[model samples]
Target: MMALYNGDEKDIREFFRVYCNFFKEQGYDVVTFEACIGMIMPGAGALGDSRVIPVIQEEDDFRNYPWDDIPELYFKEYSKYFRALREEMPEGMKAIGGVGNGIFECVQDLTSFQGLCYIAADDEELYHNLFKK
Candidate 1:
């Protein structure tokens, strides 16, 4: 399985081409393409800055976070790559959808692993609300 981060359509297509070819050369019969739905909160990997590590500084930050206001560009770019990949998919290959971070995982991303434990104990309501969002 290979996961692709956000990029222009051209770059994404080129990557798929190379990726499929490499696997074919290695005698693999199938390839999986993975892409994420944009997350509401930031984290250490993929969606957030690697240098900064954790994007959310505090638990309170989650209270008023914009859960549904993802920018148009995210979906636009994602659709572009998704369509391209499907159109360019090689014969006998299968495509798989990538589910981004789940409720628990997103919370861990917003708060660190340690912080999540603290929040879960400190406010059960807030923890549940996180999942509700």
Candidate 2:
């Protein structure tokens, strides 16, 4: 995942410039630059080294997810970043929308893989509602 360290447009631009230049210098033909806002989750836990534990442990937590309330603001911020990234894209490089995990994948990320399966089978309403959000 790409992160804007300073959350500044200039830094964002410079990041892409340096990234694309590095690839160009390596003689690789880069064609597209993709961006995404990433998944929204309550919190995360670190497992031994490279794994994470999702913070949403129960149905109530999923139902009360804060992102459900102010998605418009999130989209607005995402658009601003998209526009800035697009402007900084290397000439001739096409801008592509990054792939986002689907609802099922999101549920798995918010909860655990086993928890997601159990919830979907045991509480159909909650399962559907989680995705609706």
Best by TM-score: 1
Provide the clashing-pair count of each candidate structure: 0, 0
lDDT of each: 0.60, 0.58
Estimate, for each residue in 1-133, the C-alpha lDDT of model 1 and write its tens digit. 3345545668778877887777667877776655444342334342243344444444566655665554454465466666776766778876665445565665566656665566678877766776677
- TM-score, structure 1 vs. true: 0.64
| Alpha-carbon TM-score of each model against the true structure | 0.64, 0.59
lDDT of 2: 0.58
Error of 1 at 35 (Å): 2.7
